[model samples]
Target: MLTTIVVIFLIVYLGMILGGLPFLQLDRTGVALLGAIALIGVGALSLEEAVAAVHLPTVILLFSFMVVSAQMRLGGFYDWVTHKLAALALGPAGLLGVLIVVVAALSAVFSNDIVCLAVAPVLIDACQKRRLAPTPYLLALACSANIGSAATLIGNPQNMLIGQTLGLSFDGYFLDAILPVSVGLLACWGLIAWQTRGRWTDGAALVPPAALHEARTEAIAFDAWQTTKGLAVAGALLVAFLVAPWPREHMALIGAGLLLMSRKLHSRKMLGLVDWELLILFMSLFVVNHALQRTGVTAHAIALLAAAGVHLDQLGSLFGVTFVLSNIVSNVPAVMLLLPLAHHPMAGTLLALVSTLAGNLLIVGSIANIIVVDAAARRHIDIDWRGYARVGVPVTVVTLAIAGIYLALRLHLATG
Candidate 1:
């Protein structure tokens, strides 16, 4: 039984790294779900035990935030903000700075992927109107979103997972991450601006008319009331998470329910916008990981590693492993795999920070990166791996270094 569990865990994680099973139609989510089902079918876990293994609080919190993001999208808040930012009379560098800051700030509060999806096309159009190049700005958007999302527990999926799983304080995590995330955002802006020095204009023709028209189809006109309501709910949730003793998931669910009761945006539309596949991925991985843990293999392996002087509970080892696994299997899955080892004092903060910032290493490393790239592609602006890496590589290296230094300082303060 232990061997079977180990085999299933290995295969599922391999699929995560490869993005799917070889020649199979299954994605990471599907692979994880199948692995969980296999364990149940083979009696490694009873149906009841599998269900119990899944963390409902984390799932609820994730779902509620998705609805909040969907509400903002349907209300055209994202589009309105992008347009406003474009209308500023700043120079190329100044505008790039503002874009990075705003994108990062919004992503810290909302879904980073949705922020890119809603803003990218309109941003492309805005750049064309200004005769400025969109590539640098688009890259800034992706990088800032990934970095900024590290600022808060709810900033991205992985942070949310770490926070909920470890029961970290929302305010504590925010305070610990603010410095690294802010420095990372500034570094991202500087690198992109320097790369595009004196070449803000591509002098290229506007995107194909058909592509522009298709992109515009997803835009929602700004609805002030809906936007205001969404903001109110988000603000209230943050306050609750920080101050109130209520369960975070319960409060988030109530906020989602309030948003659902909206008369203008139908609940079906909001629900449709939620990433059901991502929810499934989390649920399935929870069951699979729990079954594996029950078999004692994971604990035994960690003990062996500790004895060999490679302690994952230490900040340095955790940071290195997180950076590599995040780039390989993407941040969310990587977080799930390493979260069990997060028993050190600073482990949760380290995991949340590294897993998120690591996504800036590759275009495929994070959903936010994919969303920005795909959005650009739809507008005929190709951001191939090479083009992305030119910016992504530097941004990732600098940000990770900042995070490492910050974590090291915190560790020293704790030990000293």
Candidate 2:
């Protein structure tokens, strides 16, 4: 049984790392679901036990936030922001700085993937209008969103899972993350600004505005009344999560219910955008990781690491391991694997921050990068790997440095 569980775990994770198994017709979500089913079939976990292994609070949190984001998406909020950013009549370098700061700030508040998806097409159009290269802005969109999402619990799915599972204080985690995120944004702007300095001086031939404008078929069909109502519910629920002393899951469910009370936007459509695959991914990983835990493999490995004086509690070691593993398997699974150790001193903050920031390391490192790249490709704006790495590599270095320094200083201050 133990061997079967371990083998399934390995295969599922391998699928995650490889972006789905070769010719297997299964993506990460399908791979994870199969792993969970395998565990139940082999009796490593009972059906009841598998259900129990899945964390409902994390799922609820993820679900509710997706609704909130969907509301904004439907309202054309992201599209509006990107257009505004593009319309700013700044030089190339100046526009690069503006784009970096704006993308980072929005991403800090919303899911990174959604932020990238919403912004990419408009940004591409905007760059074309300004007679500048869209590649730099698109890359900035991907990298900054990944970095900025590290700032808050709601910013990334992994952070949401970490925050809910560990019961980390929302305010406390934000306090820990804000400095690094702020500095990281500045660093992101600097790197992008330096790279685009010369290109802005000699503007590329402009693409027609009509061509870009025609791409937006889905207009912002916002009911101001409904949008305001959803925002109010979301804000109240956020406060409830932080301070009202209600269970986080219950508050989020209330918020979701309130959002569902709409006259125009059907709940069916809202629910469709919820990325059930991602929720399933989380559910499946929970079972897989829990099944692995039953084999005493996790505990044995931790004990060995502890005996060797390599505690995950240490800031340096924690950051190093998280950066490597997150880049390998993506941030969500990496968070699930390491979250068992989140009870260690300052571990929740470390886990959330490291898992998120590590996403900036490569093209496949974060879903946000993938979303932006894919969106651009759909519009015939090819942002290939080489184009991405121009911004990705430098952005990763600067942001991680800022995060590492901030974590080290906090640890020092806390210990002192």
Point to the candidate with the largest lDDT: 1
* Leading candidate by TM-score: 1
Error of 2 at 48 (Å): 0.4
State the lDDT of candidate 1 residue by residue for 1-416, as single tens digits. Answer: 88899999999999988889988999999999999999999999999999999899999999999999999999999999999999999999999999999999999999998898889989998898898889999999999999999999999989988999999999999999999999998899899999999889874467788987886787789999999999999999999999999989999999999999977788889999999999999999999989888888888989999999999887889999999999988888888889988989699999999999999998999999999999888888999999999999999999999999998898889889
* Candidate 2 clash figure, as a count: 0
TM-score of each: 0.98, 0.94
Model 2 whole-model lDDT (C-alpha atoms): 0.81
Off by over 4 Å in 2: 201-214, 218-223, 307-309
lDDT per residue for candidate 2 within 205-310, as digits (tens), equals 5545564555566445445666577568767866776788877777877777777777778888788778889999999999999999889998999889989999
Error (Å) of candidate 2 at residue 30 is: 0.6
Root-mean-square deviation per candidate: 1.1, 2.1
Candidate 1, residue 35: lDDT: 100
Q: Please report the TM-score between candidate 1 and the true structure.
A: 0.98
Clashes of each: 0, 0
